[model samples]
Target: TPLHLNKVRDPDDQLVLLPHGLLRHHCCYPGCPEFLRDLRTENDLDAADAGKAGDVSESTRRNGLWQHLSPKTWYYARRSDAFLVPRVHRIARGVMDEAQTLHHFVDLTMRKLEEELRGRPAYAEIQEPWLKECVTALYGEYLGIMGV
Candidate 1:
């Protein structure tokens, strides 16, 4: 689910305000393990790829074009969530039995993560439109997995 990227040239990404029902606060426990795991998932294949039947180098290139040209790109396979989610996980471990306690922190962390994503170095440097789609699409997939 790519965001409406053509909506405007607004400096801000077109992140819509969710209806109240779609918010994580409506969940039984915000920041639950399922939500966290979804954030860590790296399984977004493009629709144009015919569910990954496309060229391997395409995915390879999408996975490759990022900061430092390394797997340390934080959202790529084997690299997903490496820098962002672990700290939250560490703190949330103590409150596992009371996962709701994480709602606020989870919310903050997610917003900050989005901010970081939008601010990522060379995140949109690719002149080709389709090749540059991964960052937002994968982020959108995680949001969907989180059921928001």
Candidate 2:
């Protein structure tokens, strides 16, 4: 019989099913697919949102190399995209390889804040204080727990 995965636990007792389609699946990005390679389960509807399934498989690759897949296209033949290239490199280096969706969302938010403040000398002058305030506003004691 095939191995079965039934339950995965998250912070808030969120339950994820197991290997519904494949044991694990990653992005189709050549440099970073599987960046978040979590175990997939049969009843896991999140698989679609996770960028897995009904797309290219390992066998059907372009130029014998892994490529990204979109719903409209398979094997997106190109170098890393400008927007996602940095994230790809980060995941590949295993520097920040945690699979928490909220964490990822927070990271993105912080990046956007920093980007907006870039090149503004006035903003830069108070960057640290402003950042602290923003963090406090959003997360109260959670920032302390996060060592912020």
Clashes of each: 0, 8
lDDT of candidate 1 over 36-73, digit per residue (tens): 11121133234215437865654433221222224333
Residue ranges of candidate 2 with Cα displaced over 4 Å:
1-100, 125-133, 136-148
Reference-based TM-score of each model: 0.20, 0.20
lDDT of 2: 0.32
lDDT agreement with native, every candidate:
0.32, 0.32
**Candidate RMSDs in order:** 16.6, 15.0
Model 2 lDDT tens row, 24-97: 23332335544334323333334333435554343222221122233313122222221121122222222122
TM-score of 2: 0.20
The TM-score, computed over Cα atoms with residue i paired to residue i, of candidate 1 is 0.20
Which 10 successive residues of model 2 have the least lDDT summed? 15-24
